[model samples]
Target: MPHYKKTKIPLLWLRRHTSDREFMLISSVLVGLTAGMAAVILKTLVHYIHVLLAYGNRLLDQPYWLVVFPIIGILLTVFVVRVAFNGSIGRGTAGVLFSISQKSSMVERHKMYSHVVTSAFTAGFGGSAGLESPIVVTGSAIGSNYGRDYHLNYRDRTLLLAAGAAAGIAAVFNAPIAGVLFAIEVLLTDISISAFIPLIISAVVGALCSKLILQEEILFNIGQREFFAASHLPFYVLLGVLCGMMSVYYTRMALRVEELFEEYQSKVYSRAIVGGILLGLLIMLFPPLFGEGYDSIRLLEGNNAQEMLQNSWLAFFGTNEWLVLCFVGALALVKVFAATITIASGGNGGNFAPSMFVGASTGFFFSRLVNLLSFNNLPVSSFAMVGMAGILSGVMHAPLTAVFLIAEITGGYTLMIPLMIVAATSYAMVKYFEPYSLDTKKLAQKGQLLTHNKDRTILRIMKIQHLIETEFQPVSPEATLGELVEVIAHSRRNLFPVVTADRKLDGIILLENVREIMFKTEKYDLVKVRELMVKPPAIVQYDDSMADVMKKFDESGAWNLPVLRNETYQGFVSKSSIFTKYRKLLIKTTNVA
Candidate 1:
C-alpha cells in the first residue's frame, strides 16, 4: 500500500475519547446543568419583558401614557434590533430549530447573543409574540457553542443541542416532563438511549432552576377541576373539530401575515405604524387585544360577562351572547395576525405562548357559540380549555408538547383524556388542510429533508446518479486561481476537482478556498489549484451504498465528495443534487402512497 496519512474525523475522535459510559453520563449531567442555568437566565429575561409590556398596556389606557409608551417601546425595540444587537430576529425556539436544521451546531455566536437580547426587548415593549422562542434559542446556542468549543463530534453536538432545548423548555415552564416530551416530539424526533440521559438530566435541572427562582408561578393559574362529564363528550368532539379548523386557519393567516410583512419591509415603520394604530383601535374597542391574551383568558375565566358585554360591540350589534361570540372569535384571528406581523416586520418575539393565547381565546368564543346554539347548556369553560389545547397543538404541530404543557400549567391531569382527543383530531385536521408548519416550511426553503424516521437512510430517498457533477470540466492542479475563478463563474460547480498532469485525482479545491484567497490578497494570478487543494479530502469507494455515502457526506460537512478507487477518480457527489433528486422522489413516492 502507498503511504497514507491517518486522517481523523470528528465523529471518530468523539467515540475514541468517550470510552466509558459513566464518564459520558457525568458529562451529560454537567451539560444539562449548564444548559438549565442558561435557560433560567433566558426565561427570566423574557418574563421581565412580559411584565414591562403589561405595564405599557396599562399605560395605553391613558392618552399621554399611550403616546409615550408606544414610542418608548418602539425606541427600545429599535435600539435592541439595530444598535445593541442584530440577528435577534428568530431569537427563540423557532430560531433554534432553524439553526439546527440548516446550520447544524455551528450557529453564528453573534446571532444567538443578539437573538436573546433583542427578543427580550421586543417582548418587554409589548410585541405580540411568544417568549419560548428566545429561551430555546439561548439554551440551544449555549449548548451547541459549548460543544463546538470543546470540539465534540457531530452526534454529541446534536445531543448537547437537544439538551439545551429541553432545558430551555423546562426552565421556562418548570415542567420537566413536558420538556422531555417537547424534545422528543419537536426537536430530537426520536428517543434513543444516547440522547435520553442528557435530555432528561437537562430538563430536570432546568425545571429545578425555574422552581428555585420562580416558585411555580405559571402564566395561567387554572384551579383544580373535575373530569369532563360523559354528557360533555359530544361537545368535546365538536370543540375538537372546531379547533382543527381554527388551527388550520390560524397557521395560514400567520404565514400570510409574515409574507406580507416581508414583501413590504422597505416601508419599515409604516407597516408597523399602521398595525399599531389598528391594534390600538381594537384595544380601545375591546380591551382584550391589549397584550399577550393571558389576561384575556383570565378575564373570561372570571365570568364577569356584564363587564365584557359592557364594552358593547356585542349588544350594540344585536343578540348579546351571539355578538360576544363573534367579537371573541374575530379577536382570536386578529391577535394571531398581529403576532405574525410583529415578528415578521422585525419586532422579534416568541410564537408558542401567543399561539396558545389565540387558541384559548378562540376556544372560549367557540364554547359560548356552542352554548348559545344549544339552549345555553353546554360546558363552555371545559370545552374552551379543551379546544384551546387542540388548536394550539395543531397550529404548532407539537401535540404532545401542548397536551402536557397545558396539563402541567393547569395542574390538572384529569384533562389529559380530553386534551389527547382534541390534540390528535385537531393535528390531523390541520395537517390535512395545510401540510407545512412554520418550522417545516423554513426547512423546505433551505432544501433540507425533514423526515419522521430515525432509521430512515437519506440514500433511500436520494438517487446516486443525480449527485454527480456532470459539467465535465477537469482542471490540472497547475491551473491558476484566476483560471479556477473563470471556471467557477462559468460553471455550476461550487467545488472543483483538482487533477494531476495525468488527469488523475490529486485533491479538491472548494469555492470557499478560492474566495478566501481572492479576499485575502490580490494574488489570484500566483495561486494554483495545488496550493489551495485540501489534502486528505474525503474519498469514497464506488461500491459503497448510498446510505454509507450520505453518512460520509454528513460526517465531512462537504457539499461534494470524491468517489475514488485505487487512485482513480470516478466522479463527485454533490449534496444539492442529491437533495433535488430526493425531493422529486419524495413527491413521486407520496403520490403513490
Candidate 2:
C-alpha cells in the first residue's frame, strides 16, 4: 500500500503574495459568476413552469383554473419547505440584512440553493410574487458562505455578501448599474470607494451571464422617446405624489397582512389555506393578480391596457377603455394584497417585482386618465416607465436604485429627468410617513440594521455581555480593612465591588481612595471596608442597553461602572473595555481588512 501525503502551502505565503483588495476582487468575480448563474436558472425554471402550467393552454381560459393554480403552487411551496427544507423558507432580503448586521455576515450554507428551489416552485407554479428577492437571498448566501469557507474577516465577508447581491440583481434584470446601486443602497451601509470595484466587477459579470447565456430580453423596453418636456413636469410631479400615497398603502397593507397571517403562526396549513383562498379570489376577479403581473405591466406599457382586463369579470361592462383604465388602477391598489398574501401564505418570494408591477400600473392609469380628460397628450409609456421608479423608490426607500434601474432597463437616459423627479418626489413623500423601507423596518427596530453610519453599526454589533469584566473580586461591606488588603493583594483589578451579605451591591471602593492608608498596616484593624467604600455616581442595570450604558458612563465620568441585576452585583463594565471593544467592532464592521 502506498501512502500519499497531501501537499500543503504556508498560510503566510498566500497572505504575503496577495493584497486584500486583489483577493476581494477575485472573490467578487467568483461570487458574481455563481450568483448570475443561479439567477438565470431561477428565471429559466419559472419560464418553463409558466409555459407548462398556463401559456398556450385552455386551462388559462377558465377563470376557475386561475383560482386553483395559485393555491396549488402555494401548497407545493409549503410542502417543499416543510418536508424537504424543515419548514424554513429562508428569510429573503431581511435575512441578508440581518446576517450583515448581527451574524457577522454569516448565512446558513443551505441558503445558496434553498431559495432557488422554493421560490422557483412558488413563483413558477403561479404564485403571485417575484424571483428577484429569492435570487438576492441565494446570491448573498453564496457570497457569505464562500467568505466563511476562506476564514475571511467580517468586513470581507460582508463585502462579498453585498457583491453577491449586486450580481444577483444585475443578472435577474440584466441591469448592472442598478445592481450596484441596489447593493450599496440597500445591503451595504458602511462602504468605501474601493469597495465599489468588486461590486462593479460582480455586477458586470452577472449581467453578462444573463445577457450571454440566458439572452434575457430587456424586461420593459419603452421604445425610443423624447425627453419629458417642461410642460409635462407638473403631471410627473402629481404622478409622483400619487405613487407615494400608493407606496404608503402598499407598505401598510403588506405589514398588516403579514401580522394577520402570523396570528395562525402555529397552524401553517390553516394560514396557507385562508391566504391562498383570499389570493385566489382576488385573481379570479382580477386575472392580472395571478402571478408577478409583469406581463400585465408589459401590456400597459404597450398601450394594451384593455387586454389586461379582457379576462376579468368586468369585461362584461362592455369593451369600455375607461372601465379598463379604472380596472388597471384598481389592480394597482389591490396588487399589494395579492403580493403580501402570496408570501404571507408560506410561499417563497419577495416584493421587488411586485413593486415594479404596481408602479407600472399606477403610471399607466395616471397617464391614461390625463389623456382621456385633458388636451395634453401625456406620454403613457414614458409615465408607465417612470412610475416604476417612483413606487420602487418609495417602497424600498431606494430612490437611487430605482432611478438607475429604470434608466438602465429602458435602454437610455431619455426618461432620466422624469425618473429622478418622480423617484425623488415619491421617496421624499414616503419618507415623511415611513422612516424605513418595507424590508428593513423590523431589522431597524431591533437595532439590527447596518446603515451607512459606521458608529451606529458598530454600537449595534457590540454586545455588552462580551464587554463586561466579571473577574473583579467582590469584598464584603463588613470585611475589615485587613481583609480588604488581602483581597487587593490577590486581585488584578484596581477597583473592588463591596457587596452585602446577600450579594447585593452596597458601594464600590477604588484603590486610589485607599492608597494613603494602604501602608499603615498598624491602623488596618481600625478601618472597615464599609467605612472606606463610597457610592458610585451611577450603576448599570444588567438589561441596560449599550446606549444607556454609554450615557451613564458620560454623565458619571467614571472609569468603571458596576453592572447590577435587581440591586445584586453582576460584574464591572469599564469605559476602557467598552472603547476597546468598540474600536475592534468598528474595524470589523468597516472594510478595514
Candidate 3:
C-alpha cells in the first residue's frame, strides 16, 4: 500500500482516496511514462552521438577513425567513472541482480541516470555492446528509488522496479509483451497475479513512449518479409543446436576474457588503453562489430548483405558471396571478444545485442551455406530472425522473451513456431551445460542468487555467521561442575560447549543431562566438565551452507549445535535462532526482485 505520511503532498491525496491495488495501478502508469521517456531519451542520445560523429564531425571522417573511436570511448568512460561517479559504477545486468539480492530492493539514486550517461558514451562511440541492459538498470533504479521515497516494502518496490525495467525494454523494442516477459523471466524469482497489472501497464506505456517519441530508424525493429516453413523445421533444429553451442562458447569466452581483464583491475588506464587498442583493431577488421550492430543485422536480410564490408579492412578485396558468408560467421564468433573488451575495459554495455547479432550472423551464415552447398534453397531472412531468438534464449535463458520480442519487433508472430522451436532448443541445450545464465552465475557461486525454489532461496540469503549464538557460555573441560554451574547461572542458553585449555571444542553438555547433577550440590565439586560433557550429535562447520546447517539440525534432532572453526568452538547455533532469522528474511525475500 502507498504510504501517505511518508510521501509528498501531490501523491498523498491519491493515497488517501484509493486502495493499495488502485494506487499501484496508477503508479504503474506514471512509472511507465517516466521509464519510457528515459528509454526514449537514451535512444535519442545514442542516435545524436552517432549523428554527431557521422555528419558533423570531420575528426572521424576518415574510415580508419572507426577503429580509433571505440578506444576513445573506453578511455572517456573510464575517466567519467573515475571522476564523475567516484571511480565505481557497476556494469551490466549482473549489477542489477546483485542489487536485488544484497540491497533491500533499494537501488541507489545515481543508477537512475548513471547508466544512461555511461552507456551513451560507450555505445555512441562504437563500443560493441547493447544499451538494453543500461535501459533496464536505469529504469529499474528509477522505480526502486521511487518506491523507496514513497516508503514501499520490498515486494511492492521490487515489482515497481521490474515494471520500470519492462517499460524500458518495451519502449526500446516496442514490444510490450516481450518487455513484461523479460522482467518476469530474468528479474523476479516468483510472481503473483497482482504483479502482472503493473508489469503490463508499464510495458504498454513504455511501448507508447517509443511509438510517440522515437522514429522508426532508431528502433531495433526488423522487417520480416518471409513466411515460416514447417518443411524447414529440420534446418531450424540444426540452427537451434548451432545457436546453443555458440551460446555456450559466447558465455564461456566472455567470462574467461573478463577474468583476464580482472587481473588489471588496479591499472584501469593501461588496461583500457590496451583493451581499447585491441577493440579498435577488431572493429577495424570487422566494421559490423562496432556499436549495437543492429544496422548490420538489418543489412543481412537484404541483397546488400555484403555492403557491411564497405568500411572494413576486408574492403581491399571484392565482396565475394562465400567471403560475405565467412565474414558473417566470423562476426558471430569474434563479436564476443569485442563486447567483452569494451565492457571489461570499463565501458558500459551488455551482451543482449551481441547475442542477437551473433544469432543473426549464425542464421545468415547457416542458411547461406545450406543454399550454396545443397539443392534446397533456404529462407535467409527467416533463419536470421529465428537465429536471434536462439541466441537470446540461450544467453539470457529467457526463451519466451526472445520469442515474443523477436516476434513483436519484426511486426508479427509469423515465425512463432520457429521462434519457439529455436528458443526452446537453444535453452535446453545451453541449460544442460550451464545451469545459470550469464548474469546470475557469479551470484550463484557466492550463494547470493535468488532462485524459484523458496526454501533454497531463503537459505542462500541466510548466512551462518549471522545466525551464530555466542551468548551461550563456554565451559572449559577441566572446569569443575560447580564452576560450570556458576557460569550457567549467568547464561540464558541451556546448551553449553566444552572447550579445552587451547579453546578447542572438546564436547558439548546438554541442559537435560546436567539437570539432575546441578541440584545435587554434593557432587558439584566432584564432577568435571570433561567427565560430564559428551560429544554433540553434530558439529556445524563455519563455512557450511544454511541448508547444511538445517540438515544437521534435522539429523541430530537437537535444537542447538556447536559451530566450529578449524575444530575450535566459536559458538552454538540454535535452531530457534536460525528459524527466527529465517522467518524474518523469508518475509523480505519471498517473491522478491
Candidate 4:
C-alpha cells in the first residue's frame, strides 16, 4: 500500500466537493455556449448554401432552376436522412416534445448535428421552412447527452435539455427573455422558481453570443412605432379574431397535408418527389414562399409592397398596387401549403417562422384593406407587428411567449398593449376550437404529454409491467388443500391464484382465509382448494390503463389484485409494490437534482 500511487479523477473529485446547485450553474454556462455556437453555425451554413445556390451560379435569374433547387434540396435531405443518418433525424420541436414526454428527455446523440446538416441542405436550397425548430432539436440533444455522460438525474437532465433549447432560441433571435419564456411555455412543464436562475443564465449567455458574434440584423425593423391608439383597440380585437380563424384553418390544413404524405411513407422517394414538385410549383407562383420568407416580412414591415412582388408569377398581372395587395393576401393563404409541404416531404424544419410570416402578412393585409376603405388610417407597420403575436399565440397556444417575443425581438415594448390584446384574444379563440397546439395534439391524445402536473407526469412514467409481481405462485383449482399448504409454505406471497389446466384464472385463495386450517393436517386432505377459493371482487386487465387500474383498486378496496389477460392468470399487482414504484417515480419526475 505504501508503494502504490493513486491517480486523481478530477471530475469525481470536483463532484465530491461541489454542491448540486453549483454543478447545474456550471453546466448551464457550458450548454449555453455550445448551443449558441451551434445556432450560429446553422445560420452561417444556411446563408452560405443560399448564396451558393442563388447568387453563385446565376440561379436566381433562372426561374426554372429556382423551382428545381427546392426539389433537389428535398431529395438531398431525404437521402441524408434515409442513408447517412439511418432515418433518425427527427422532425423539429415535435421530436423534442416527444422525447421529454415519452423518452425521459433522452434525445438520440445523432440529433446533435444531423438536423444542422440536413436542415441546412433543405432550407439553404430554398425549402419553405425555418431553422429555429431544427436548432432547438440540435441544442436539446447536446444538453441531454451532456447530462447522460455525467450520469445526472432525470430532473437535472431535463432542465439542462431545456436550457440548451432556450439558449439556441435566444441566440437565433437575440431575445433572451423570450427564450426563457419559450422554454417554459413549450418544452417544460412543472418548473420551480429555482429553475429560472439557470434558464435565465443560459438564455442571456446565448443571446450575448448571438449579439457579439452573429450581429443579427433586426428582423422586423419598423422604425419608431407610433404610440398605441386607444381608438384602434377595436381593430386589434378584430385582427385577433381573424388571425384565430386563420390559425384554425392553418392547423387543419397542415395536418391534412401531413396525412396525405404519410400515405406514401413506405415509398420515401414517391413522397419526396410528390411533395417537392407541389412545393416547387407553389414557389414558382409565389417566390416569396421560397424559404422562411423573413425577407418578405421585413419588406412588408418597411412598406416596400412593390418590392415584395417583384419576382413572382403574379408580377405578370401588372404594376397596379391593388393587384400587388391581392397577391400579398393570396401569399398569406398559400404560404401554409408551401411551408407544410416543405416539412411533410421529409425536409428538416419547423412552423415557427412560417407562422410569424403568415401573421405579418395577415396583419399587413388587414391594415391595407381597411386603409383602402378610408374608414381610418391604421398603422400598417404596428398592426403588422402585433399580428405576429396574434398568429404565434394562436398556433403555438403560448400567448405570453408570443407577446413577449414580439416585444423583445422588435427591441422595444412600444406595442406591448396591442400585443397582449391580440395574443390573448387569438389564444382564447384557438383554444376554443383546438384543445392542443400543432406540436402537442397527438401526444396529448395518446396520454403521453407530461405537463407541469406532477401527479400525471409520475403516472405517465410508471409502466405497469415494472409493477407487476410475477413471483406469485399459482395452483390448480382441482388440487387438494394439501397441495395449497405446500405452495403456501414454499412461497412468499400471501395470495395464491387458482388456475385451470389451460392456465385460466378460476379463482384465488387468500392465506389469511385458510390460516387456521392451513396447519390442520386432517383438513388438508378433506378440504379441496376449490371449496375454499373465492372469486376476486375485481381483476385488472393486462391492457388496462393506470387510471383505470387505480379506479379498480379504489372500488375493490383490495391490497392485492390479480392481473389477467383474456381470462388467463398473468400475475398479481400489489398496492405495496405500486406505492413503492410510485414514490420512486415521483422522486425521479419531480427532483430538481
Candidate 5:
C-alpha cells in the first residue's frame, strides 16, 4: 500500500479534556457514522456495478456472460490486490480477530479503504461471495485507527473496533439490534454490560444511516410473512438438525478448499484464473450462486422458487417439483465451494452472506420436499428466513446474532420461537463437532486465538519466545570446578547451563549441587563441570506453545527450564517470567472493570 505521513488528530484535545467514559460515548457516534458511510459506499459501489453489468449492451448481448463476468471480476480484484496492495491485504474477520488477540487491536489504516475497494470489485461483478465481512473489516479499521489516533488505551481501541463493526452490520441491513449482537457474539464474547452502550450507540447510528440513505431495494430485507404456527414446531426442529449438518459440511468443505488454495497463494494470478473459471461454471449452472444471492433469498422467501429456477440454466433439463428440489439442494451444497473459490482465487469477500444463502436454499428445499410428499402445509417463507439464522448460528457460532439479525430484518419477532429452536439446535450440533468457529479454527490451531476460556486466552497471547532469559550465563562442560566457580561468582543466577564448545547443551549445573565442591578450592581443578552438572528434570522447546511450556513447568516442578531447539542451547524459561507476562496481558486484554 501507499504510505502517508502521520498527522495529529484534532480530537486529542477533546479526549484529554473529557472523562474516558464520556469521550468514548461521543466517539461511538463518530465511529458509527463513519462505519455506516463505509457500508453505504461499498453497497452502492456493488449495486451500480451490478446494474451496469445487467443492463449494459455488451454484457447483456453476451450469452455466457455469467461465465465471463465473474472471471473478469476476479481478475480485477487480483490485479488491484497484487499491484496496489503489494499482493496482500487483510484476511477479513479472522484477521480482525488476530489483530485484537495479538496486535493490540491496532488495525492498519490502509484496510479502511482497501477492503471496500477490493470487495466491491469481487462481489460487484458476480463473484460468489459476501460483502459483509469486508464491510466489517473496513468498519473495524475505522474504529481502530480512530482510537489509535486519539490516544486511546487497548481496552478502548478494542471496544471501538467492535463498535465500528456493529455499526457496519447495522447500517448494511438496517438492523441495529443484530449489529450489536454481532459485535458482542462474534467479536467480544465476554464483554461487560458497561461496554454495551458504545456498541448500542454505534449500531443505532448505523441503522439510521441505512434508514435515511440506503434505498429499500439495496437492503437485505423481506418484511415478516404469516405469523408462526405452533404446528410447524417439529419441522423447525428438523430444519435445525439439517442446518446443523449442512453447516458442518460448509465448514469442512470451505476449510479443505482453502487449504488446497494455500499452495497457490504465491501464484495469485494462476489461482485467480482457475478459481474464477470454476466459480463461473458453478454460477452458470445455478444462477443463485452469483454475488450475495440475496435476490434468490427473496425469491425463496416469496414462494417464488419457480421464478428462481426459471432464471437458472439448470432449468433447461426439467422444471418438475422434484427436479426443483434437487436443484435447490444442489445450491446449498455448492455454495460453499463457490464462496471459497471466490475468496481463495484472489477475490475479497466473506462467508456471512453465503451462509445465509445456503441456509435459505436448504430451508426452502426441506419445506418444499415435505410439502410435495405429504398433506402437511408448511410455511416456506418462515422456514427460509429461519434457515438463515440456523446456518448463521452453526457456521459463525453466534446463535444470538443469528436469531436477532433475522428477526430484525423481518421487522418482527413472530418467528422468534422457531428462530431460537433452529439457531440453538444448529449451534449445539456444530459445537459438538467443532469447538472453534470457522473463522477462528485455524488461528486456534496456531495458538493465536483468544477465546472465552480465560486461561487459554492469556496463555495464547503470551509468546514464550520473548520470555526466555539468556543472562543466566553458560559454562563449558569441559571446564574445571575452579573455572565454574569464577563464572558463578560473576553470574547472579543460581542455575547455569552446561554447554559444549559448539554451544550444545549437555545438562544444567545447580549452585546448591556444587556448593560443597566449590569451597574446597585446593582440589577445584580435579572436579570437572560435566561431573558437577546433572540432566534437567524437563526441557522446553523454543517453539512450544505457552500451554505446553506451562505443562512442562508443572510436571517438572522447577522454577526454570532449559529451552532448546534441535539439541542446541537457547536459554532458560523461568516460571516468574511467564507469570509476569501473563499477569500483564490479563490486565491488558480484559475489556471491563
Candidate 6:
C-alpha cells in the first residue's frame, strides 16, 4: 500500500499534517534503496548470461557467439522497448539530458516505471552500454515521482530529482564523490553549499547500500602499470592532441551513424539484419570491437599474442598488415556504424561505452605510433589507457569523472598527472569544437542553449544600490487628482508610488493615468490617485535572481516595480538604471554585449 493510504485512520491524519518535502525525502530513500537492489540483481543476471554464453561458446567451439551477444542484446532491447516501455523509443541518458536541459525535467512521472525496467534490461543484455545512465534515469525518475506523489512544489521537485540522480550514480559506480560531482557538473549546472547536504546524504546512503551488498572490486582489473618517465612528457602531450582529434572523430562518426540508421530503418528488420551482418563480419578480424571493449583492453594490456610494432606506423591504424589495417579499420568504422544503428533502430542503449571503446583503440594505436619512432621509457599500455580516458572525457566533457574513473580502475595514482594532462588537452581541443558533446548538441537543436560554466546568477551582476527615484513623490491612495497634479508639478518623476494609510504599497500610478483622465472633462477634477492606481502590480523579493527578475519584467511590462517581503514594502527598482549600469560594466569588462 502507498504510505498515505494505509488502512488506518491515523495514517491519513499524519499524511495531512506532515510537510510534503519530508515525504519526498522518505520516498526518495526508498527509490535509492530499490534502485540499488535492482542494479545488484540486474548485474547478477547479466553475469549469469555472460557465463552461459561463454559455456555455449566453449561447447559449440565457436567464439562468434560472443560477437553475437550484442545482437541478442539488441533483440531483447527491442522487446523491452516495444513491450515494457510502451514504445517510448530513445529513452537513454542522452534522452534524459536532452529532456532536462530543454524542459528542466527528466522522465515524465507517468512513464517512470516503464523507463527503469527497459533501461536496466538494455544494459544487462550486453548493449555496448554502461549502467550509469540507467542509474541516473532511475534515480531522477524516482525523485520526480516522489515529488509528484507527495505534493512538493516545482523547485523542490527539481532538487529531489537531482538528488536521486546523484544517488543512482553513487550506487552503480561505487564512486560517491564522483557521483556528487557528476550531479553538480552535468545536471544541476550550479553549485550551492546548502544543496550538497541532502544530496550528499542520499549519495552516501546509495553507496553504502552498494558496498553492503557487493564487496568493493575495481570495475576494471588493470594490473601493475610501468610509469612513464619525465622525458616522455612531450610524447604524452602529442598523445593529448591525438586524443582530442580522435574525440572529434568519434562524435562525428556516432552522429553520422545515427542519421544513417534513422534514414534506413523504415523497412522492418533492415537495420537489425544489416547491423548483425556487419558486426559478424567485423569480429572475424578484430574481435576486440565486441561488447564493452573491457576484455579487449585487458587482452591488449596483458601478455597477448600481438606484440607492439616498433618499426611501423601502420600498426597505429589498428592492425599490422597493410591489407589487414584497411580491413580492421573499415570493420572498426562499421562497428561504430552498427552501434549507432542499434539505438536509432529502436534499440535502448547509451553511447558512453562505445565512445570509450573507440577511445581505447585510438590510444592503443597511438601508442604503437609513439613506440615506432623509438620513443623511450613510455609504457604503451598506459598510453592506451590515457587515450581511452581522454576520448571519453572530451566527448562527455566530464573531465574529473573520467580522470578519477580511469585512476581508480587502473589502480595507479602515478597515472593521474598524465591522465589529467591528456584529458584537459582533449577538453580544450574540443572547445567550441562541437558545442559540447553529442547529447548537448541534441539539446541545442531542440532550441536550448545549455552552455557550460555560465554566470547566470543574480550575484554575478546585481548592483548594491542604484537610482531609487526619490524625485517620485509618494501619494496616498485616497488623494484627489487636483492634489496629485500639484504634487506632480513639484516633482520631475514620471511614475509615483501610491501607499495606503498603513504605509503598505497600493500600486504604481503612471503619468498615463492622468492623461487618460484628461480626455474626460469631468474626470480631471473628480478622479483621485486611488481611482487611477493600477491594481495587482508586479512585485518581487530582493533576493530573487536577476535573470528571473528580468523574465518577470518582460512578462509584466513594468518599467518600475515594487519590492516586498514578509508583508513589508521595500524601495522600488527602475529597469533603466539597471540596464545602463549593466551596459557600462559589460563595456568595461570587454565582454560581448
lDDT of 2 by residue, 1-593 (tens): 22211211333355457888777777788899999999999888888888787765768888888778888888888888899888885668898888876788899988899899888878876788888899999999988988886778887888888899999999988899999999989888656787899999999999999888874442434454556788999999999999899999999999999998888888888888787888889999999887777788778778888887678888888769789888988989889999899999999999998999999999999999999998589988889889999999999999999999988877889888889999999999999999889998877777777654557656765667777788999999888899999999999888999988898999989999998998899978888999999998898888888888999999999889988887878898998988988887665656423
The better candidate by TM-score, 1 or 3, is 3
Q: Give the TM-score of candidate 2.
A: 0.92
Candidate 4 or 5, higher lDDT?
A: 5
Highest lDDT: give the candidate number.
Answer: 5
True-structure lDDT of candidate 6: 0.62
Q: Which tens-of-lDDT digit does each residue in 120-239 have in candidate 3?
A: 999999899999999999889988987887777888898899999999999989999999999999888688877898999999999999998899889878777899877999999999
Q: Which ten residues in a row have the lowest lDDT in candidate 6?
A: 584-593
Residues 312-357 of candidate 4: C-alpha lDDT, one tens digit per residue: 7767776686887788889889988999999998888998888999
Estimate the TM-score for candidate 3.
0.95
- The regions of model 3 sitting more than 4 angstroms off are 1-7, 58-61, 451-454, 485-492, 518-520
What does candidate 6 score on TM? Answer: 0.68
The Cα local distance difference test for each model comes to: 0.65, 0.85, 0.87, 0.84, 0.90, 0.62
Instruction: Please list the residue runs of candidate 5 whose C-alpha ends up more than 4 Å from where it truly belongs after superposition.
Output: 1-10, 56-62, 451-454, 457-463
After superposing candidate 4 on the true structure, give the runs of residues whose Cα lies further than 4 Å from its correct spot. Answer: 1-18, 215-222, 319-322, 452-454, 457-461, 515-522, 591-593
- Candidate 5: deviation at residue 11, Å? 2.2
Candidate 5 lDDT over residue span 1-593, tens digit each: 22322234446666778899999999999999999999999999999899899876557345488888898999999899888988888788899988988899999998999999999999999999999999899999999998998878889999999999999999989999999999988888778889999999999998899889989999988889878999889999999999999999999999999999999888888898999889988877787787889999998999887776765766687678888788888889999999999998899999999999999999999999889989588989999999999999999999999999999999999999999999999999999998888898888877777745667867876776799899988999899999999999999999999988888999999999988889997978898898889999998988888889999989989999999988889999999989888888887777544
Give the alpha carbon lDDT tens digit for every residue of 485-537 in model 6: 77877877777888777768888778876765645656656887888888635
What overall lDDT, based on C-alpha atoms, would model 3 receive against the true structure? 0.87
TM-score (all chains, Cα) for each model:
0.71, 0.92, 0.95, 0.92, 0.95, 0.68
Clashes (N, CA, C under 3 Å) per candidate: 4, 1, 0, 2, 0, 0
